[model samples]
Target: MTDSTRPTALVTGSAGFIGMHVCERLLADGYRVVGIDSMSDYYDVALKEARHARLARSNGFTAEVGRIEEPERLMRLFEANTPDLVVHLAAQAGVRYSIENPRSYVEANLQGTFELLEAARAHPPEHMLLASTSSAYGASTEMPYRETMKADTQMSFYAATKKATEAMAHSYAHLYGLPISMFRFFTVYGPWGRPDMALFKFTRAILTGEPIDIYNHGEMSRDFTYIDDLVEGIRRLADAVPERPEGGVVPEGDSLSPVAPFRVVNIGNGAPVPLMEFVRAVEAATGREAEKRYLDMQPGDVPATWADTSLLNALTGYAPTTPVEEGVGRFVDWYRGYYAV
Candidate 1:
């Protein structure tokens, strides 16, 4: 704790790609940040460690290593710290991986969130923001996904688990009067991104003279959001705490739950760029033409994703604006510097 006067933020998955950036932003904003991460080997553990190492340089940051699903892990944290703001970003990520290992999804996304919500119920925060996914909009052919839209058709187990957590949070909010926001994120990318993501994999393959997989035969599109942009959204939304509507009269177009102090907002770039276009941007950034191997779309994968960010703008007066080309260029630069390529 740097100072008792400063606000405290407990951030789960603090060493993850998005989590690291969020923790850094909160620390920069002068908040005392307590971060918890399991350091799961799903991706490169070294990358996760490096993210935490950077945060350790900040005197305001306190790092904790443990699984969120572990019994009493989050409860002990809440008991000791009593955080003012809680950001739940920890989970088992990846749609394809979830198919191979559905149990991980159940443990991390489902059980882990149960533990978090229970802890929050014990020591309620001013605001709690949990990360959901655009994949929650599964099977919808709508051009741009919205927060108020019916998102019951989650295509993958990963998405299903994420949606389940949103429901779980809502129930807690209703029961305990906890202020909660569920953020439905689109395709996030940029510097310090995950190795499993397309931007990272494409950049790595292109630089190493290897072929990149072009799923759905380059017929895909994603609202590729930049890392900085996403972090800014999270920071802004932290202050936009939800309040249960009076008399159960919710405003039109608002996803705020009438029964609870809860809402779901879309955090995305708002522009869906085609797969070939994204690859071209990578090539431009890396100065290497990628060898492409066209393949059918993976199971549980959608061909396109677009976000409707009106609710986010309405609430926080901000939306993600980074273009894929610029975001991809920054990521390639970071990748080269990070790997010494």
Candidate 2:
């Protein structure tokens, strides 16, 4: 039984990397957290289990194993928990994986999000924050992407599904008066990150004296936001519920919907670091140079991504600005300790 005094939050993908961190933060902040994850085999199930185990240590956190696409299950959870805040983070992530298995994205990102929206509509929360991606700004060569900019040109199926969720959530918000915020994340990485991410892969390859793949021949760049910073940004944004602007007049640089209580905010470091520099940071942390295997840019891959966090700053009075070197060093330390390398 949850304490009636504290507010409850239903977080999907609770066992996932970001989900685990967010659950910890919420529990620390005195919220009762109901976390759900399907434990999909996309990456390391063991890692997901480890994250779940950590969260289970908290009395305020309840872990449930289920897919978000299961509408009946989600509805039951909503009815039982009656969460004041809902955070939707469960999705089939990874760009290359989406290309290999597009159906997974369709099922998890599209169908799963649809189910979540239905549940939220039935049991409306005070605020609902969904995770979008920087990839939604696909093919837009604009540096420092702003949330107000048009984001229709998604280059990957992963990005397309995320963009679709934003639209789906907006419709629900407009029709049902649900307060919603979509966070567009830029290259999130740190300890306990996905095994599929570059930081993990590069660290492992370097430690094992193997060649690490360098796409775009080290020409690419990313606004690598640290996990803690990203979680902190989300924590603040959860309180900054958007309201439909009166007179259809959104503030300059804001992405608030004029017709609904909806907005998209970019959570990023706001500093795009080159791929090689990131590799060098890994080397500095691990004390081992990576054997580089340069390769052509993969399909659905963009050359760079930089976030314009002005709207985030205006809303939360803070922005993610962790330097790559320090962020990468922390990841390397965790990798070494976790893997005993």
Candidate 3:
């Protein structure tokens, strides 16, 4: 532990994409850290292992290879570590994948969170931030998603589970007095990104002379947030956790519960970029034009994802600011160096 004064924090899914970067930030800030991940083979197990390898090199960071849904294991870990703060990032992630495998989402997102909530009831952390997805804003054509907006209609099973997790977290917070923050992340990309993401697939296809699938007939757009920008938002959020309103009169239609210290925040680049523009940035970075495959929109996919991060900035004084062009270029450079393409 670098700073004994800093709280010990536990990050679930620390071997995953955002998890790896979050762990790095937590360690850099001198927090005694413990990371838990099952290292599921949803994408590439080697990629997850590589992330774990990097974190293992840090003295303040520790990891365990296990599943979070296992109640006994989770309980034992909580009992031993007694973490002062918890960042729940582990889950069976992917909107399209959820269409094929709904059970995985139930096991990881629902059951796993249930396990964590139960454990936290006995030993409550000062603050708990859980990962939610922008997909939670399903079926709403509203641009710039706000934290207070209603998102009852979810398009994907994965998103439904995540949205459900937010509800579950709120229940726990209200009943157990847990300070909880649920963050809805927009399209996140950068170094060490998941192989299934469009940016990674597009870059790989462009370099390999293969066709990249342009979904929604290439009309889709997203608030493509860089990993560093998102991580910075999360870091700042760790300290700006919500406290139960003294008067118990919370805002209306808000995810915030009057009885609990819980609220949802959107972490995204407010600027939404078109698909072609993002691809052009990648092309410029690789100096190669991609073979494009215009495909129909797949099930459980949205045409766009725009985040209204005004509430975030108003609360924490910061929102994600990375431009899509620069963020894409950085990812391409990392991909080329990583794969020697």
What's model 2's overall lDDT?
0.93
lDDT of 3 by residue, 256-277 (tens): 6678899998999988899889
Residues 2-65, model 1: lDDT tens digits: 4799999999999999999999999889899999999999999999999999999997999899
Q: Judged by lDDT against the true structure, how good is candidate 1?
A: 0.94
What tens-digit string does per-residue lDDT give for candidate 2 at 167-212? 9999999999999999999999999999999999999999999999
Q: Which segments of model 3 are wrong by more than 4 Å? A: 1-6, 251-255
User: What pairs collide in candidate 2?
Assistant: none
List where candidate 2 sits over 4 angstroms from the true fold: none
lDDT order of candidates, top first: 1, 2, 3
Q: What is the lDDT of residue 224 in candidate 1?
A: 89
- TM-score of model 2 vs. true structure: 0.99
**lDDT, candidate 3, residue 337?**
84
